[model samples]
Target: MNVETTVADSSLLRQRAFVAFWLARTCSSFGFQMFSVAVSWQIYSLTNSALALGMIGLMQFLPSVLLALPAGHLADQFDRRRIVICAQLIEWGALLALVLLTLFSWTDKTALWGLVFVLAVAKALEGPAMTSMLPSLVPPAILARATAANAVGGEAAVIVGPTLGGFLYVAGPDVVYSVSAAFYLLSLVLIGRIRYTRPQQPRLPASLSTLFAGIHFIRARKDVLGVISLDLFAVLLGGATALLPIFAKDILHTGPWGLGMLRGAPSIGALLVGLWLSRNKLEKNVGMIMFGSVAGFGVATLIFALSSQLWLSLLALAALGGFDMVSMVIRGSLVQLDTPDDMRGRVNAVNAIFINTSNQLGEFESGVLAAFMGAVPAAVLGGVGTLVVVGVWMVLFPHLRRRQKLENEAAQE
Candidate 1:
């Protein structure tokens, strides 16, 4: 086992395809983050309406909700790499258009929204293809570590992208858009360099059943269902981070600087932990560890909710982020490792919907609950609810709770 692990660890470091994929994924993240900052600023500058800003999110979210399953089906039936490339190509074209329009002073709020929607549509199609490709790039033994490494790239991009965009925007919106487009071009080129053995899958006809195969696949696998749903409910209940602004302004009596630091705490924590996990392995009692990490996340959320001190709140938020990272890495690795290659795209699509919707809805849930009660109580309730969910899920999915490895079912077959 030690020899095997040594080989796996080395394989991860030397895997060329995975390396390209990681670089491509990181470039894509940087572009997306830069584009987000540019578009938001441009939209608000044009309309100066908060409603218009809200509509941007609505437009972006609508496509994922509507197209994710179809996108999944497409991933299953075609070259996953090509699908990702095509989606990013579309995004790159949109960014180019944005650059031209902004340069000419021809872009309006409506045009911006339309462009944002197009980008979102491409993202919806790209997400599942990108996610489902990871398991094929490296040995299953290192998938969790690879996932952590992937996340570290994203975390680094998130920390840097917006600030970079903001600085470039000083030159103008067009400059930011131009730089973002360049990143997408790099991502496309890197993706083109990736090589993988595509499994021979039967050409499944398009039908309701085919489109929804991922749902059925997940439902039949109790372990997969448990992991997916546990994340959904736990995140849905533990979205107290959404109340940061409220806490900063009303409770903590601080300025935007404080809010910025508060907002950044979680990402910093996640990034540090991700770096560690990338070098280390989670080789034993993974299921229990995942559950415990989630419970720890809840405990951190509860502490953050109750804390009146800024330092303590930041610490709690950071802890929650670290815990959440552990859970995310475990859950993602397990699902991908256990799934068949033919069904991976569709399954990941369903998983994407769960992840995306849970985050958006979790924030929405916290805001609504905060409106009814108060930020503190709402956050406290969310933390407690997350803990309750962890307990319930452990009871409900005994097999998942006792699971010990991240072995690839397809490889064994």
Candidate 2:
């Protein structure tokens, strides 16, 4: 270990703008997680249909596919901070509407889905601007740490938000919505206080070229393309979490509580690893480390697919999460550092689309595969497929595989 580089204090906490951004992100992420849980429960109660629950996901995903590119263009052409603020305001209003609708018993499944769709639209607009703003908050030297820290906040929210929402739902769905709205309001205040200076650049006219510029730019940079596509395929193929309900019931022979634990295990593992990465930098052979992490993820998933015991399966899932965190930190830092400041928004917008597509489609892919084969075989196939992807990516993007050091890549450019 390099002692000089291993200093746990990366000083990110001392940067006021970065701190504000971090806290604001954490608050909003918590709100979204809690909101998702409450909305699902309420929708199920109202409609009493599993298809209704799936519809909610479709409602949330459609905007990412449809709006992300245009939203990215807006991020590059306009004030990123202002865009984020406006997006959060829209989310806050939607949450407030949910509270009122639930309080008055005016809420129906359709109304719930519509409001959720509105929130998703706001998120689609906010993601690119918010992501592109991170490079400005901290020095380039510690961006990997900053990205890891950001993941820590998000993972923490994922682990706790649903349980908190579930507990608050015992009071009423309105109570949960009210708390979630409060969290969003807090996020709005924090983000509003952040200071940023948008560079002077000629505003380009809206056109097919301007809208698709992010995609074009990404295609020109092999390293960035490799990192982004690697993540897309890794999660796309390694989506074993989608089959947790199946594992909890028939395979693991456990109940709802067991399923909850199984669901939370990966987040717990990711959180722990994220915390570690936030403190320590990957100072050498970062590309190789990233590839290794993905490979480790595949191995963990395979272990999970084969395990019948709940304990062993949980361990495998946790390992999978930890390896994923390592790769996520590397991939996120690489993409941000390699992209120029002027095009960061558009590039990140493209990145967001890939992420959203992978997540939504990964679940769909898992379900279809599981239906054709048994859950174990499908999950086993996913795990093995992830390994194959890593091998092929290494061969396809040789420069990315041989790269060393996170910051050095940007310097060489």
The top-ranked prediction according to TM-score is 1
For candidate 1, give the lDDT of residue 123: 95
Every candidate's CA RMSD: 3.3, 4.1
Mark the regions of model 1 whose C-alpha exceeds 4 Å error after superposition: 1-14, 408-413
The alpha-carbon deviation from the true structure for residue 412 of candidate 2, after best TM-score superposition, in angstroms, is: 8.7
- Judged by lDDT against the true structure, how good is candidate 2? 0.92
The lDDT of each candidate is 0.92, 0.92
Tens digit per residue, CA lDDT, model 2, 109-208: 9999999999999999999999999998788889999999999999999999998999999999999989999999999999888877768778998899
In TM-score terms, candidate 1 sits at 0.96
Clashing pairs in 1: none
Instruction: After the best TM-score superposition of candidate 1, give how far the Cα of residue 344 lies from its true spot, in angstroms.
Output: 0.5
TM-score of 2: 0.95
Displacement of residue 296 (Cα, Å) in model 1 is 0.7
